[model samples]
Target: MRATLIYGLGDVRVEDVPDPVIESPTDAVIRVVLSCICGGDLHSYHSWTDSNPKRMGHEVIGVVEDTGADVRRLKKGDLVLAPFTYQDGTCSFCRAGHTTSCLHGGYWSRFDGGQGEAVRIPLADTSLFRLPVGGDSELLPSLLTLADVYGTGFHAAVKGGVTEGSRVTVIGDGAVGLLAVLSAQQLGAEQIILMGRHCARTDLGRTFGATDVVAERGAEGVTRVRELTDGLGTEIVLEAVGHMPAYEQAIGVARSDGTIARVGVPQYEQAPVGNASLFGRNITLTGGVAHVAGYVERLMPAILDGTVNPGLVFDRTIGLDEMAAGYRAMDARESLKVLLRP
Candidate 1:
């Protein structure tokens, strides 16, 4: 079996690794069908300094190859949506729809990488959502979104309190940012200002329901967002760029008493959250790792009914052996998102 491993900063490789097998009663082995790269993966691509390489990739769609004795909800041949994290469904946090905090849950990279031939899924029955579609469906790409990006976008909108006729600003034009625009649209936001510099990506943001696009950064970007909102800023700000600069922009574009939902994996430890930032405006800080397993069912119906196509975010596809090039393409900003067919 081949899997991606990150040896250090900017170094990603596809190397042969041992096959996965069921190690616990709650486990299941899956043959990966489709996987994709995420912006969060770039955080590691930029600054991983560990002595040994770590497994890479989390979002995956796979078919059940084997199951442990305790696994009842899945069987061989079942195509499933494997969210990034695996959790025991009955845990208190999972019951509250916060699967990311499940007592027995953790991310995929802890063991097998999604960008591989196969993976052993822990807490199988609860973590893997069985998709109604089959392996060869044209909707696979969209269904794959339930694994990470799409749901993450929705988490931002939901946590930020986006609602009907709400005014919103989304920072970043990456897949999550563009999809956050889509999520705000689905929630009926009347005004969506997308702050991105890339024409191609910001163009997609517009198509996803951004009423205006601000192709600026720093103070200039804040000025543009405020101008679009009559110099008052928006009711909700979705910060999808995990960088410190984007965080500052989110504060700038957030109206008094508004909400800032940060879905991007934070790249820094210290940030402004006091009177100089959120406290001065009475703004609330929310959002964290998305509970994709919890969001899969709610978001799947729209895709199943063909009401929306979130898969447009994926701009490239490669084989398992081509993952090295895939990482380069994404790192260099030549690809919006890369899909892997293994």
Candidate 2:
């Protein structure tokens, strides 16, 4: 089998690797049909300095090839959506709808990255969600987004308290950010403001539900958002860019009582969160890793019915061997997202 490996900064390769096998009673092996290169993957591809090669990818939709003895929820030939993080659905956190924080769960990459021919999923009964239909469904790409991107975007909107007639601002124009715009629309936000510089992305944002697109950055960007919101800023701000500047923009554009839901993977180790920046305005900061497994079931119907097509984010599709090119295209902003067919 061939899999993607991140050797070091700016280096991604596809090389032959041993195929995975069920290692636990609850484990299942899946033959990947489709996978994606997430923006979060870029963080590891660019900054990881470790000498050891790490398996890549987390977003995947595949067919079950084999199942462990105790795996009852899935069987061979079943098509399923594997969330970016694997979790034991029976955990307290999972039961409470926070699967990302499950006591016995971790990233799928820790076992065997999703960007490969096949993967061994632990806790299969609780980790993977079987699709309503099986075998090369037309919704494969859309279903693929449920594994992470759309669910995470939906999580950002949910955490920010977006509702009917609410004023929303989304930071970052990446795939997740665009999906956040779409999610905000689905949640009934009357006014959606997207802060992005790229014309193409902002255009997609508008299509996704952004009523306004602010192409400025930093203080100028904040001013633009304020001007659009009558100087009080937006009611809900979705921070989908993991950079310090984007975080500050989210803070600056949030109203006094507004909430900022940050779904972006933070690049900085420490963020300046203090009374002067948060308490003074009475703004609530929330959102972390998304509980994708929990949200998948809820969002699937919309995708299946063609109501929400977050799969549009996949601007390019390539074979497993072209993983490096996919990374470069995403990093260069030449592609919004890349889907890999293994």
Candidate 2 residue 1 C-alpha distance from true site, Å? 0.5
Q: Considering summed lDDT, which 10 consecutive residues are worst modelled in model 1? A: 104-113
Q: Could you tell me how far off, in angstroms, the CA of residue 306 lies in candidate 2 after the best superposition?
A: 1.1
Per-residue lDDT tens digits for candidate 2, residues 214-319, read 9999999999999998999998999998999988898899999889999998888787678878888889999999988899989999988989788888889999
Each model's lDDT comes to 0.92, 0.91
Candidate 2: worst-modelled 10 consecutive residues by lDDT: 131-140
Model 2 alpha-carbon drift over 4 Å, by segment: none
Report the Cα lDDT for candidate 2.
0.91
**Candidate 2: count of backbone clashes, pairs at least 3 residues apart or interchain:** 0
lDDT per residue as tens, model 1, 128-182: 9898987899999999998999999999999999999999999999999999999
All candidates: CA RMSD (Å): 0.9, 1.0
How many clashes does each candidate structure show, in the order listed? 0, 0
